[model samples]
Every structure is written in structure tokens, then in C-alpha cells.
Target: MSTQQFAGANDRFLRRYEYDDSWIVAADLGVADDAVDVDVVGTTAIVVVDTGDGVAETEFELPGTDADVAVQNGVLTITVAK
Candidate 1:
């Protein structure tokens, strides 16, 4: 398992876990699911979240180029192909 925490404008954190054929990246952002947006460029994943007060953005390296993103219960989950 790989874990990383980013300190920026807001309290944001990222966690990654290695699986058999894929990697799981999770971000804990206490916001609505519709307020989170994710985009992938090359091996990097860019995450943008609307925090009501303002917008917070962060980018991190992904294990692979292809990624699937989802948000649930204020948690952002991403699965990358490896």
C-alpha cells in the first residue's frame, strides 16, 4: 500500500493501494459527490473539489495512464489500470 498526504489550501489527503492488476487511489474530501471532478493526463491525476467556501485542486502521480474515478459519501475513489 502506498499512502501520501498533501497539505494545501484545505485539508486534503490521498491514499493508494496496490492490487493484482490495478491500483486504487482514494481521497477523503468531505464534500458532495457532484462537487468533485477528476481528470487524468498521462500518468498524473488531477482532482478538483468545490469546498463551498472555495475551490481546492491537487494533482498526483498515478500508477498507470488509464483511470476510472468515482465519488461516494464525500470520498473520491480512483482505480488505475496497471
Candidate 2:
């Protein structure tokens, strides 16, 4: 497995892991599940979160075309096929 770190807006960080067949990206935004939004366009992944104080947005390169996104316990997890 391989790991990568991405610097995000507001100094937030994203952790990425690569497995045999998939890639997983995760971040803790300290927000409710309903307050997060994720979008993928080609090889880019866009993440937007409502942090109560305001909105935060970030983007990073993705390794795959298809993605599955989820937020729980104020953590965002995105898994994509590789």
C-alpha cells in the first residue's frame, strides 16, 4: 500500500491510501454528515464542508474515475476504484 498527504484549504489535510484495487481519501472536518459535499470531475475530487463558522472547500487529484463518498463522526471518507 502507498500513502499520500494533501494540503487543503484553511490548512486542512487529506490522507490518501492506495491498495491493490482501490484508493481511499479521508479527512476530519468536524462537521455533521449532512454538512459535507463531495464531487468528482474526471481525475479531480472536490470537497466542500460546512464548519459552522463558514464553508471550506478543497480539491485534489483522484486516481480513479468512480468514487464512493461517505461522512460519519465528522470524518469524510472517499473510496475509488483503481
TM-score for each model: 0.83, 0.84
- Give candidate 2 regions above 4 Å deviation: 7-11
Number of backbone collisions per candidate, in order? 0, 0
The best candidate in terms of lDDT? 2
lDDT of 1 by residue, 1-82 (tens): 5555555465566677887788888878888999988888989888888889999787888889888888999998889888
Shift in Å, residue 41, candidate 1: 1.4
Model 2 residue 54 CA deviation in Å: 1.4
Quality of model 1 by C-alpha lDDT: 0.83
lDDT of 2 by residue, 1-82 (tens): 9999877555767899999999998888877889989888988888888878888787778788898888899888989997
What is the RMSD of candidate 2?
1.6
Model 2 TM-score, 2 decimals: 0.84
State the C-alpha lDDT per candidate: 0.83, 0.85
